[model samples]
Target: MRNWEDIGYLQIGTSRQRQAHAAFERLGILATLNAFGPVLAGTIPLNIDLPSSDLDLICEVPQLALADFQLLLRQHYGHLPRFSLQETMVRGCPSVVGGFEAEGFAWEVFGQPQPTRAQHAVRHLLVEYAVLEAGGEAWRQAVLTLKRQGLKTEPAFAQLLQLPGDPYAALLTLENLTSAELRQRLPPLRP
Candidate 1:
């Protein structure tokens, strides 16, 4: 079989992202989650979804009554399809993790401590966006092909695509590259 991937935006629209964030705001989940630190990181925000991608969020829960915050999320939004908010851990600290749907997007939020959160960069999403901006459909599909073939992380995708740097480093540096530049960056596939 040949390399298969996504050529265009996923069927979901950008509005879904706003709606989810809005729901977080309207429900005060944003502010509540923010007490620890706030961020939405994952395939959804990056707009790079596989056929089965779900939303992932990173948050840090404060030691002060984290249980109360998590409970609030579930009590307020649990009615949503597949909602399952619960206390969880990230890098050995406490967090809340679960999924909920809003305006047609499937979302998963993970609350993590500030220090642990710092190590998780959303730049991968930025890199994907930059690649999308610079290289358009072909680059996206190529990356998706790697993803579809079970190369989940960006670095693995970049490595398989023969990109010039560490998968992580290359993506951070790949912004504004043209289609030709992208093609140029790709070394010939090994036999």
Candidate 2:
């Protein structure tokens, strides 16, 4: 696993980045994940994100203990506005999806079983790590810009960047492109 620096969390490109970092730090997301389980996935960890984008995260749990997980969320974030938690699944693994408002931003979390490739979270996490290692700031900038245009979801946003395939595949594809080329890359709107 890469250090926080290597993971690009220390980079502060925009106010949104600063807020996301501060919130994650104050909330002890990684610490919480460590206590309960592994972080199956996270979008903010990429270092470049839209101001309006909620932190997308997934954690592993003993099982899909939705009630217990909700208790934990309540313990840590009950005070947050618009807080809501429900039982769900991520790629067949029992899971919980929770949403809340904090620090003037929204946070969406999915807690699932021990991560596996079957989980979209796990696959996307791998791709995110790859992009961080190979794409650097250019990839981050390109992603952020694309996101600001209201193309917030993956694969679709990835497609617009013309990187290649879906989001995960596109990240893999984009990671290999030159930083200069990536910075200049323009996203297109389509199906």
Give the worst 10-residue stretch by lDDT in candidate 2: 4-13
- Model 2: what TM-score? 0.66
TM-score per candidate, chains pooled: 0.59, 0.66
Tell me the tens digit of each residue's lDDT in model 2 across 1-191.
Answer: 54432324434535566676677777776675565544424555665555555776666666746578778887877788998888866447577888898766688877766753435655655555554445565656666666676665475346545665556556655444454565455443332
- Residue 37 in candidate 1, Cα distance off native in Å: 4.7
- In the range 1-191, model 1's lDDT, one tens digit per residue, is 11112212323446554554555555555555555455555565555567577656555555675676677677767898888877766558676677787655676766544532343445465556545555555656666666777887676557755667567766766655666686566545443
Worst lDDT 10-window in candidate 1: 1-10
Off by over 4 Å in 2: 4-8, 11-15, 28-33, 38-41, 116-118, 132-138, 160-191
RMSD of 1: 7.9
Model 1 misplaced stretches (Cα beyond 4 Å): 1-37, 115-123, 126-137, 155-158, 161-191
